[model samples]
Target: MRKFTIALDAMGGDFGPHISLSASSKSLQLHPNLFITIVGDAQQITPLLKKYQLLNHNRIKFVHAPETISMEDDPVSVLRHRSQSSMLVALQLVAKGEADACVSAGNTGALMLLAKHTLKTLEGISRPALVSALPNNRGGHSYLMDLGANLQCGCDTLFNFALMGSVLCEQVEQLSAPSVSLLNVGRESNKGNDTIKQCAEMLSATEFINYIGYIEANELFDGRADVVVTDGFSGNIALKSYEGMGRVFFERLQQAINTTWYSRLLGKVLNPIIKNQLKNLHPDLYNGASLIGLRGIVVKSHGSANESASFYAIEQAIKEIQWQIPACISARLESVLAERDCLSHE
Candidate 1:
């Protein structure tokens, strides 16, 4: 079995090393061939590793990073000054081939800037887009891209997102020619802004892409499209809305179930079934969003992630490393760009 090494930014996110160390310990036990490089303040991480009884584990290596990039830190400022921060150090590990991948629950903007600078984008990929799977009604997940990465994208950039997203869904979801759609105001051709309309036209003309026209926000989880592409601003808003709605829905349902004696009795019978059915939609299960199009693997975990969510982020990194996602996307882009050039000449 091939051993995989993942570098964790132990001092990123809300709970910092507490959550990361617990997740790392759990991951080490789960995957015997997995090695972890914990990057953060040695003074802080050492005691926790001892708490987790992983202080001197053979499979674990510790790298002391003196600084940390806070969630509120400016991306540009951190990029210029915090070279020795835990987040940057973890990313450097992957860039230098010291680790297979890097996982961080750090500031999204900082991670994006640092990753793009250190690892660089793959050939022909101008910028890296954040992509993650959202559970859909079809008993599977739909891939969404540009989630809070590039806030405003041009037509060509949006087109690139579609290509990247399609490749991700095809490779990771094991779908043949996964259906791709642009998130629009409506399904009609003339329903969106100039950039979206132009992107739609480009996708429609590309024979290599399985372009299926437009999909509105309400249909995001309808599972009609396997890959949904959008600008970062819109995508981020839609993602947050979906998460908020899910939380509200579950909370209201529980409250209603406890409203009456009969309801309480019925809730006992339905609680297990509802939980099993909705387990896939749990936010923690989909906590890690991949910063795709980069030369190396980097996964961004939600800042508020707990032990289970953090573990899921680490697992996501392992899967991407095994899938060789960057190489796959590069090869796909080469083919797609060649086809575009051919179409242009004619």
Candidate 2:
């Protein structure tokens, strides 16, 4: 069995090292080839390891980091300074090739900055995209990109995001020439802004991309396309809104289910069906977002992730490490860009 080491920022999340260690413990159970280097204050982690009965585990190691980057830290500041921070240190390990991947339930801005500063972007990739795969209507997952990494986007960057998102869906989702769509206000060719229109045109004309045209917000989660392309600002708002709405929707439904004696009785009967639907909507289950276009696999777990959520992030890291996701994206990026360049010159 091939071994894959993940550098985990054990000090970054809301619950700190304890939650990270618990998640690491759960991950170790499933991935026998996995080894993890926990980066945090050694004292804080030692007790957790003992609690988890992981004190002498051969697969686990500890790297003492003295500092941390807070959720409010500016991305530029973290990038410029904070080299010894738990977030940066974890990224540094991946940069130095000591780890196959890095997983951190840290501040999104800080994590993205630290990753880009340490790992840089892949060739032909202008910036790394914050991507996550969400369950879709057709029992498949749709890959959405630049979730919160970029605030603004240009045509070329949008194109790159599309390529990166495409590579991810193809490699991870096992889709052959997966369909791509521009997240727009409407489906008409000229509906969105100039950048989106350009991206749509390029994608539609590209022979390899199964460009399916624009996807409105409602249809996106319905699996209208395999890849939904959007900039960071829009994507971030959309994602958070979706997650928030999911929470409210579920809570309201549960409240209604238990509103009356008859409703409560009916809820018991329909509990399994409702639970199966709710399972897919849980943000914790899809807690980790991939920092795509990086040189090494880096998964950014939500800073507020709980135990099982952090484990989900670790599992994401394993899949990316196992598939050599970054390398695969590089190869496909080179091919796709070369084709586009050739076409442009034609």
Q: Output the number of the lDDT-best candidate.
A: 1
Misplaced by over 4 Å in model 2 are none
* Model 1 lDDT, full chain set: 0.92
TM per candidate comes to 0.97, 0.96
| Count of backbone clashes, every candidate in sequence | 0, 0
Predicted structure with the largest TM-score when compared to the true one: 1
| Candidate 1 residue-wise lDDT at 162 | 89
Tally clashes: model 2.
0
User: What does candidate 1's lDDT look like per residue over 242-331, in tens digits?
Assistant: 878888988899999999999999999999999999888888898899999999999999999999999999998988988889999999
The residue-by-residue lDDT of candidate 2 on 175-213, one tens digit each, is 898988888999877798999988777777776667888
> Each prediction's Cα RMSD?
1.2, 1.5
| Candidate 1 Cα errors over 4 Å, as ranges | none
Write down the worst ten-residue block by lDDT for model 1: 164-173
TM-score of 1: 0.97
